[model samples]
Target chain A: EPEVTQTPSHQVTQMGQEVILRCVPISNHLYFYWYRQILGQKVEFLVSFYNNEISEKSEIFDDQFSVERPDGSNFTLKIRSTKLEDSAMYFCASTGTDQETQYFGPGTRLLVL
Target chain B: QKEVEQDPGPLSVPEGAIVSLNCTYSNSAFQYFMWYRQYSRKGPELLMYTYSSGNKEDGRFTAQVDKSSKYISLFIRDSQPSDSATYLCAMGGSSGNQFYFGTGTSLTVIP
Candidate 1:
């Protein structure tokens, strides 16, 4: 079965440094999303992408965060400057259509010091 | 109020026992309900997806949605030790492209 895949299973960065998380969604999926979960907290949606552009974003998706479908298969989330609060597990997901069940990748754990 | 609320249970059960997990939501417009299972240090894996209000069954897993009461549930019968994981309930609506998730309930099935 086709599955979403994310690179760099774990990353550690210093404060004020930049980090980019990458994901390769299922080949036939049309919608991609980024979500994050702070330790002991619920998973929160950050942004949704479709048709090569952002379809929607949450308040947590602020100026420091950006997402891009850099190519046919790669989707990325770049955090300009990492902070202690930015430490969390970031998940990438994809769906064949909007409002459908999404498939999630194993997730990239980011730890900022 | 939070859009979706779930009890964060570290619920433990013996093998072959039945397990029930539940969640409630404040959004009346939510029409899509889903359950996901996540192992420690892993992203959530979709286990069941239901549209509107009804019961959906897949093997030993059953999902129930009550839109009027803003509630949903996942039931696992003849549960095995491998079924131990964190269960999360998520709801989505037409107005939003994102799904609001509940704090997951952790389960441990002892053999």
Candidate 2:
């Protein structure tokens, strides 16, 4: 079965440096999303993307965060400047038109030191 | 208050025991409910999906939703050691693709 895939399973970056996390959602899916989980915390929604534009975003998605569907298959999340609190496991998810179920990738663990 | 709430349990059970996981939500607009399983340091994997209020069973797992009470549950029958993981409950409204997730419950099935 097809599944969402993400690159750079693990990343370590210096504080204030930029980091771009990449994801390739299922080919036929129309909606994509990003979520993050801090250690010992619940999964938090970041943003949702559809039709090349942001459909919805949570307060956690602030000025430093941006998402792009640069190509038909690639969806990227860029953090302009990372903070120590930014360290967390970032997950990418996608769903078909039904929009009921979301498939998630293995996740990229980001560490901003 | 948080949109969704769950007891973060480090519940341990013997192999072959049944496991029950649950979540409650404050949002009445949520129509889609899901349960996901995640191993340590890994992303969540979809386990069960239900719409509105009802019950759904797949393999040895069962999911129950009570929209009136704003509660949901996932039950694992004849659990095994492989069932050890954190279970998260997620719900979304019909308006968009955004989903609200529970804090997750950790379970350990010792063989």
lDDT scores for all predictions?
0.94, 0.96
Candidate 1's C-alpha lDDT? 0.94
Candidate 1, residue B16: lDDT: 97
Q: For model 2, how does the per-residue alpha-carbon lDDT over A89-112 read when each residue is reduced to its tens digit?
A: 999999999999999999999999
| Structural RMSD, model 2 | 0.6
TM-score of each model, paired residue for residue: 0.98, 0.99
What is candidate 1's TM-score for chain B alone?
Answer: 0.97
Query: For model 2, which pairs clash?
Result: none
Q: Retained native contacts per candidate, as fractions?
A: 0.79, 0.86
Q: Write the per-residue lDDT of candidate 1 for residues A53-74, one digit (tens) a residue.
A: 9999999999999999988999
Q: Give the top-scoring candidate (TM-score).
A: 2
